[model samples]
Target: MTVPLAATDFHADLDLALRLADAADEQSLPRFDAADLEVSLKADHSHVTDADLATEQAIRDILHAERPDDGILGEEFGAEGVTSRQWIIDPIDGTANFLRGVPLWGTMIALAVDGVPQVGVVSMPALGRRWWASAGDGSWTATSDGARRLSVSTVDSLDEASVSFQSISQWAQAGKTPELLALAERVWRDRAYGDIFSYMLLAEGRIDMVAEFDVKEYDIAAAVPIVREAGGRMTAFDGTETLSALSALATNGILHDSFLSLFRDLPRA
Candidate 1:
């Protein structure tokens, strides 16, 4: 049952992405609130456990069987096969939250059309919520028990915006730490959502902006469409149309150009 890549109808693909997210949820939710949050650290200084690997492998198997023709790029398994229309997966996006019973953790899935994500899904089983959007359908959030629409806030100025930056180290690694600090100086407030959820909050209008450096394709691929469709904008530091693996900025539409100007000259702090 290979999922074909014949220019997926964004609406249909977004629906399937959420269903795929459900499959991941089934594998992750029970372990999420486990009595013991014990975890083993990876050599790279990051963390992973059976839940992360298992959830990702389970998703890969489903993608392999359900969309054999479609390619996949995932955090746990790396990239596989060929197709411009690949599905990006971050099986359990905030292991720290999952490990600590924080409930901000979630799984991300997105269908990239010729390298641009056109359908995105983010599901947080512990939180009992999920959000999704396609190129044109707009973003939405649903709980295991209900439904609701999500959109960014109308905060137009950086001084009024509620923003989240994934990590301080992420920007430092890219030599954008100074730029980040400057932006921080201007914004209302900030926190580190550290993964997919920050972008999710941005789309839901709960957070106004998110910028991160040193990320891979799987990290931001799934959030682009959801944010864009929710009346927001997402692009690289240069304000390009394409979402890059290196860096990304997602902002409510009202703050797009104004914020881009911040990146014009990297500050030295």
Candidate 2:
């Protein structure tokens, strides 16, 4: 049966996004923890596999038939329309974890209007969790018990904050490791939460900040709503509306500006 994903209110869209996630989970979860996969390197050497392609195709097919007017930009398929109202999807946000059976992977889908994300959903089926948000009604999450609203932590001081990073190799390759390392040094603590979950935690107020370089639109688009709707700030390291795919910083709103200053001294190499 096809769930229409027809929602009229903010919470309704949240429900629909989650329902879309449920559909996604049904297709992807059974394939996880599989011993054999046709994993291989892409042109840039980032890992990809049959799961990524098949999951994306399933989501794309649903969107195409359900909301034909809406555009879509997927990790596997190229852009499908010329409209500002577009859906950005990363069928599995942490492919590495998915391939390794790490249970840290999740599906990501976002609705971006004129490049601004207004709806976001992240579903980690293996972990049995999901989070979603709309532009106004606020961000939220679901667990085994029930759903709950999310709010960023009130940790006002960077010296007392914990920053969740994406990856060391990602930062090093972007030539921004020095700045990233310095930021880590300034923070009270750091951990590599890599991929969609870090920002989701930021939304839930469990983590104080996150920064990373070398990301695709699909990597962070769905995450923006979860963060912003929770009252955190997400943007380029320098506080721009958007940076090229290589740079981003997300923090509880209070830490954004002061935190960006820590990057002023990133030594060029």
Best by lDDT: 2
| Tens digit of per-residue lDDT, candidate 1, span 1-269 | 01235545666676678778888988898788687645788878788867888889888888888889999999888898875889999888888778887888888898986787888888887777788887756788875557677788899888888888888877888877777888888899888876788888888888888888766778788888788878888887778766554778889879978889877855444
Q: After superposition, how far is residue 140 of candidate 2 from its true place, in Å?
A: 0.5
Candidate 1 local Cα displacement, residue 86, angstroms: 0.6
The TM-score obtained by model 2 is: 0.91
Off by over 4 Å in 2: 1-13, 265-269
Worst-scoring 10-residue span by lDDT in model 2: 1-10
Residue-level lDDT of model 2, residues 20-85, one tens digit each, is 787789878888988777798988788988888888888888888877888999888778895477
Model 1 alpha-carbon miss at residue 250, Å: 0.6
State TM-scores per candidate. Answer: 0.89, 0.91
Assess candidate 2 and give its lDDT: 0.82
